[model samples]
Target chain A: PSASAEAEARAHQTQLTKPAGSLGRLESLAVAFAGFQGCVKPTLERIVIRVFAADHGIAAQGTSAYPQEVTAQMLANFCHGGAAVSVLAGLLDADFRAVNLGCVGKVAPHKNLIDNTIASATADFSSAPAMTAERLSAALNAGFAQAQQGDLFIGGEMGIGNTTSAAALLAALFHLAPEAITGKGTGIDEATLARKTQLIGKALKLHRDQLTNPAAILQRLGGFEIAALVGAYIGSAQQGVPVLVDGFISTAAAAIAVALQPTLAPWLLYAHLSNESGHKLALNKLNAQPILALDMRLGEGSGAALAAGVVRQALALHNTMATFADAGVSHAD
Target chain B: PSASAEAEARAHQTQLTKPAGSLGRLESLAVAFAGFQGCVKPTLERIVIRVFAADHGIAAQGTSAYPQEVTAQMLANFCHGGAAVSVLAGLLDADFRAVNLGCVGKVAPHKNLIDNTIASATADFSSAPAMTAERLSAALNAGFAQAQQGDLFIGGEMGIGNTTSAAALLAALFHLAPEAITGKGTGIDEATLARKTQLIGKALKLHRDQLTNPAAILQRLGGFEIAALVGAYIGSAQQGVPVLVDGFISTAAAAIAVALQPTLAPWLLYAHLSNESGHKLALNKLNAQPILALDMRLGEGSGAALAAGVVRQALALHNTMATFADAGVSHAD
Candidate 1:
């Protein structure tokens, strides 16, 4: 009965103002939205982006390819309209909002911040994760309510050492060992990579029970930002708007949303495959195929945002191109 | 003087109703039009596609990646709109015209044939090339005069086992060994690659004198279609219409065009970087950067034609996008 809603969405998708299936992936996305909303002509109006950002205790472990400060720096850049996502969101005509779900001690609210502090990142998972379940849910609810107006919502994450957390969480969820999921996050080398993998292995043992519960798994190993993204994902589907799943970390959150409510998978459109090895696992878990395959690893919803541009073109082309019948070009081979 | 004319034509690429430089490669192409005519606001009207098609004598050598008949069959597909490029050009509003500069005996002309039946293809260089220098030049001249009214010209080629011909020609021209220039055309495997490289080595020895002149090069190892593309490139430059260079074979022709008159190089814009290894070498020789890098191996100007869409987007974006001041958005951080 639940699958029927997405199916209804799909039927409406083929009936859009274009030749059948002409827009390619965009047609699929429109169909996905139809399924999510259970509508024939799903609206994608009032687009909103809920960007969840946090700090990772794993940064103390020196796990990231970039310095931990970059997470805070980029978040500020997003607020100041100087980031790639800021420029791209302008290109996409999407409303861009960033929430400091958790960061190092609550800083003053910036222009993009729709939600205040959840905590300054998770506790260094090497000891114990920094957050409790209540904080994660509060942050999630705040971001979700802010996204209520949009018929399409996109969620992104900004956290130092988040990939380490994402890889650890994916390894546990998929029942694979760490190395299989870990990758050069922000471009680390052999020695640092080995340690990063080991740290995740150690964290799993410390938080086994919490890791079993999908929400608990997020709190146990995911960044506050990642957990908020999961909440946003779940909330968007509950609101009947299509939600675009960004790169690997966002996918990690998405996988949690799907696990909690299996029907949520129908609402998500994967933007692009990442250079992250864990992303392939996430895609496999969600049964999703992304549009672009360029080896992009940068996050900040850039993949999803860029992919939106392609999808917009696809829809326009699908809707605008004259069919053989209308063009009067003889169809005779 | 010829170089200046081509450069000026390139500079005048169409205004496309977008900001100048907003669409990058497309803007460059619009500029190519100005460079072509040495004027402003160049039109992309009256497109001419000089498809230099030739059957390689090497098809008999059984050293190609794909079967020889695939070439002739593919050419038939091109005329019938079953080939990808045929669909692409139609999609992009570019008028497509294929030429049969050379092919095997008794090859019939098809609907898209702009120039038909120049020769049945070059003779195997391993034996003696099929045509003399005078014959190659005559066929090339025929193609040059085929499309007199076109505002732009792009060269494409179809030849079974033609990569072997290309490698042999390149090897001879640069005085490099055959292996340095050979590639898996149409997907030949490792052992076959070795045999093909060995065969090219033998042909180079026999065709050494052919390197002395461009016509002699065509007579010795280059395909009849390639020679036609060379002439078409020159003719497009002469007529002040930009020339679009397709994959390896077309670039080979462009190489000959540039060698004959260095100024003709300015009249060309690379459409795609084909899956062939020799393509990069040719691009390096011309010092050109392709617009798209989608791992496209299906040649027939599919890459170039698809790139036409991107170029169009670039032009539209350039001409249409509101500058920061116009959009009322802050340009500074």
Candidate 2:
């Protein structure tokens, strides 16, 4: 982020026809964009959303309500442009891509699908580590390579029982109990939620020592798509493209990515606070205030996709609004 | 809101790719719109935003940071399409109108400007009732008249020191101390906020008995634009058009409107939670959950205008997104 561009944007905001700080978060959002883009007039004309699809081995433990096949099925839906994120991408005219980091079954090829499979599925963390270090690095590189040029980047995930993995990851990193950060994913009943919590507790205990290191944490407890999203966040920041972090799983990935590189924090904008019970706690740990809070718990970058319009408007207002002098309006005393 | 249309929308939601409650607030918002429009597929193609501009005589008590002249100045800014709300309305392609409920100085008229001036300015509420019963009724009628044909209605206000009046109204209605509901408006310093709080306390004491009645409360402590907005909310509901209420003053108006006719609550959608201190209390009193919480305090319907995009996308997704059967996707168990 360019300090000079941010300063210029702040000066320009004061000239806009409103009281200083009256626009509040919108003003800060535009200024942040200016800094991120290193231009006084930043525009969100091009948004690239990458939905990383994988299957979590934890699903075998009855941690999620849906079958693991749903992961590959949803990936197919993304390819067919029949998913919520697909519709939202069209609404924002954003470039949407489905990156198959890993899936248990074969995923049919599509023009918009990027096949970068590291493994068919992760190992169930309740019994063992999710992935090897080599596989984790491969997943990270795949996401880093897919971080193409765009005005903004959004990373979403799709994996059955991935919330279990995310909860374990957050519990390990934040050193909190599994029950404190466990939530029902895909609308599970009370029994399933309780079982999921127990499984996460076991996983956290299994990876307790390894949790001290970020790379070890990802290798031991994170799914392929989770690692990919972490890499995507870091890669987007490296490429000077800001990333809009999605819901719980994505935010968990962000916590790992930012832990590895604190500088990436400035490049990340939380899109929404999910309805998932753990989301607020995870977001608080990352010191993020998301743009929307519609209690949306759906993953697949849908929340981030919805927020794209708000970011676009912030840019539009920043670039197009006439100054007080231009409008002949009186300045605040 | 039509129950049959809402039921159809809910059934369609279950047929979508995600879980029944996965989309959370988005699902409820879409269902609410479907019910409001009395159709399974509701569209937000036409949005009408009315920004009521009026001067507050309370500015004479040093209750605000800006001079009262800013009320008329911002009205011109809105007419010139240079204000925050104006830029946001243009971004959303919503029809924007600046209704001059009352301004101290002459405002050059435009086609979009509604000349409904009931008074040059309201009396200083710190000393006396802001408006006569007759003037209050006229202001309400003007707002009611502007609630014409549109898929969605947004009511915003631009009145200097009106927060004082809003706080006084809320304090009188809720039987709370003025300090609890008063906040810094338009970036006031500590001293100014203290002074504003004291003035509101005085006004509340003077209007204690009249505040028991909603109409009397408006006449005693509301600005012309506030009364007009209260009327607009009621009129829009009476006309079967859902209204999106904006910020502190707008919420105050909504409180009065809902108090007068509790049925109007179903016809209102809160746009955003403002940074003002009393806004949350007012919204809680009405049992309303706003769509956005950007800490925005810039009146003129800017928050509502920004939220227009979100509502439009919700409508678009509800109408266009393919169902699980249509898209050949499997549903959850």
Candidate 3:
């Protein structure tokens, strides 16, 4: 991000016919784009959206409302343009793809589906580490390879029991109570929610010594898609592209990414606060202010895709609006 | 709004790809549009954006940050495609127009400018009624004439001291303390806010007898542009077009319109919560939940124009996204 370009954009906002700061956060959003693009006026003509799908072995404990096969099913749904993120990405004219990071069920080949399977599924974390260190590296490299240069990058996750993995990882990383971060992903019953919480608590106890750092925590409790998301975040930042982090699971990936590389913090922008119970807590840990809060918990990068429109509009306004001198408008008294 | 269509839309939502209610407020938004358009799936292809610009007599009391002449200047800006709403409307491909309800300064004619001048300006409301009953009727009729059949209707306002008028109207209508509703308009200083508050309190007392009804209250305290907005809101509802209400001043118009005809409430959807202090309180009075909260205080229907994009996306997803059965995806267990 260019500080000089940001300063120029901030000064330019004051001359855009409206009263200073009247456009509120939008004014800042435009300036942020200007900084990211290293120009006084930035355009968001290219948006790249990637959704990584895998299966969580924790689902073997009946942790999720849906069966693990749904992960592979949704990846097909994503490629066939039936998933929420697929619909939104099409609307946005974004470069959209689904990365198959090892789902339990078979996924058919499609133009939008990337075959990057690291394993059939992670090991159950309640008793064993979710993945070996080598598998974690494979998943991270798979995600890192997916990142390409674009105006904006959005990483989405699709896995049946990924939220359970996210909860356990976040609890261990942030030193939080498992109950504080556990939530009903894909809508679970009260008893299931209790069981899910207890499972995460037990996993935290199991991986206590190994949870010394972000990478160790992810390798112990994270799903392939989560690690891939973490890789994508770092990769996007490394490529000088801004990332719009999605809901709970995506945010968990972001926390891990930012924890590993603190400088990656400024390159990330939060998309929305979800209905997930611990999204706010996770976001607060990163001091993130999400752009939208519509109670959406469906994570296929849908939230980020919706916010892409807003970012586009903000840039459009910044680049197209006439200055006070150009519009012949009176300045404030 | 059609109850049957809304029911059908809700049912249709549950059958789509994602989990039930995973889309959050967007699901409800699509359902509402379905009800408004009387279809199971609604599409927003035509958007009409009208910005009413006038001068407030209250500006003479030194309540605003900008000169009264800036209203006419912004009217010109709106037509010339330079203002915030103008930029947004262009981006949304909306049919945009600026109606001159009465400005202190002369406004040049343009293809998109409507000459609906009710008077040079409203009378100084601190000393007398803002408009005569006849002039209020004229302003209302002008706004009513602007309402046309479109997929969506958005009403915007531009008056130098309109926030003072809005605060006064809301305080009197809701019977709240002057301090509770008064806010800094167009970025006024601390002293000006206090003065604005005191002046509104005084006007409420002076017009106590005449403020018995919505029409009377509007005639006594509202700007011409505000009256037109009220008329437009009612007119849009009558034409079976849903109205997306803009910021503080626009919400005041909605309140008056809803007060005159309670049925008009369902026809109106709030665009965004403004930086203005009284907006939330005003929205609460009508049970309105705005779609965006970017802290925008620039009222030219800018917020509504920005939200038009969101509404369009919502409808597009509703009308076009493939259903679960269509994609052969499994439902939750």
Question: lDDT of model 3 at residue B175?
Answer: 92
Report per-candidate DockQ: 0.06, 0.70, 0.80
The superposed Cα distance between candidate 2 and the true structure at residue A241, in angstroms, equals 0.6
Ranking by TM-score: 3, 2, 1
Instruction: Report the C-alpha displacement of residue B103, candidate 2, in angstroms.
Output: 1.2
Better of 1 and 2 by lDDT: 2
Model 2 docking tier (incorrect/acceptable/medium/high): medium
- List model 1 lDDT by residue over B62-150, tens digit each: 77644554555556556666444665566656778776665653344767865556556667778887578687778678667754666
What is candidate 2's TM-score for chain A? 0.98
- Model 3 scores a C-alpha lDDT of 0.91
Off by more than 4 A, model 1? A1-47, A105-108, A149-151, B1-333
Considering lDDT, which of the candidate structures 1 and 3 is the better prediction for this target? 3
TM-score of chain A for each candidate?
0.88, 0.98, 0.99
Q: What overall lDDT goes with each candidate model? A: 0.66, 0.88, 0.91
Cα lDDT of model 1 by residue, A25-127, tens digit: 4556655555555555445456687677888888889887555655665566667665546656765678888877666643456767665676666788779
TM-score of each: 0.59, 0.97, 0.99
- Candidate order, DockQ descending: 3, 2, 1
Error of 3 at A52 (Å): 0.4
For model 1, the docking class works out as: incorrect
Residue-level error in angstroms, candidate 3, position B320: 2.0
